[model samples]
Target: MRSASAADFNATRFIARLRSRGLTWVLAIAVVLLQYPLWLGEGGWLRVREGAQKIDIQLALNQRLEVRNASLLAEINDLKQGRDAIEERARNDLGMVAPDEWFVRVVPAQSVQSGKTNE
Candidate 1:
């Protein structure tokens, strides 16, 4: 028979004690309970990752809004400071005519743009 070495003897005694005291099950439950807060808890890595993704989405939305705001601000400043901008909007959007200009709008019977030539 092969003699048990000190390492093997210690390991054997440790397993026996664990089996007798049911420490294996207690340790397993303790480890799982401790891991709960790290993986599935509110302040855990999963929640942190989700929060980071939300922050990234919000930051991108804010950047796009900022660009749109800058464009609106430029348009507002142009309308405030320039007569040409105001005149262009009035002429195109409201169909405003000058006092000396003739407003001649010819009504088309057949819409010439939709593959129909009024020839």
Candidate 2:
């Protein structure tokens, strides 16, 4: 057995000291193993964060769609309940006129002269 001397650096003693702290190394390895799934594995913190962001985007899109659907429903209700709405839509979309109304088309003088010249 070699006696411990203050001036002597011992590799055997250093290795024994490391072996004495074996429990600490085991606990550190266990911590790393447990943390692996929390940070990098499936359904981990990163995956949960990404899923939350997707849900937020989908919720925003649903809100916008709901608003659009509500506006469409209101327009449908207006068209169903009011003849004025129907008449306005017909006039704007189909260019319909009342039976008593006369339709007049105005042509520019330059266009008329250009047509005559082309002919």
Model 2: per-residue lDDT, tens digit, 1-119?
Answer: 66567325587678778987997899999999999999999989999999999999999999999999999999999998989999989987898999999877677799897785423
- What's the lDDT for all of these models? 0.90, 0.89
TM-scores of all candidate predictions against the true structure:
0.67, 0.69
Best by TM-score: 2
Q: Please give the clash total of every predicted structure, in order.
A: 0, 0
lDDT of 1: 0.90
Deviating ranges (above 4 Å) for candidate 1 = 1-21, 102-119
Task: Kindly report which residue stretches of model 2 are placed more than 4 angstroms away from their true locations once superposed.
Answer: 1-12, 20-24, 102-119
Q: Output the worst ten-in-a-row residue range by lDDT, candidate 1.
A: 110-119
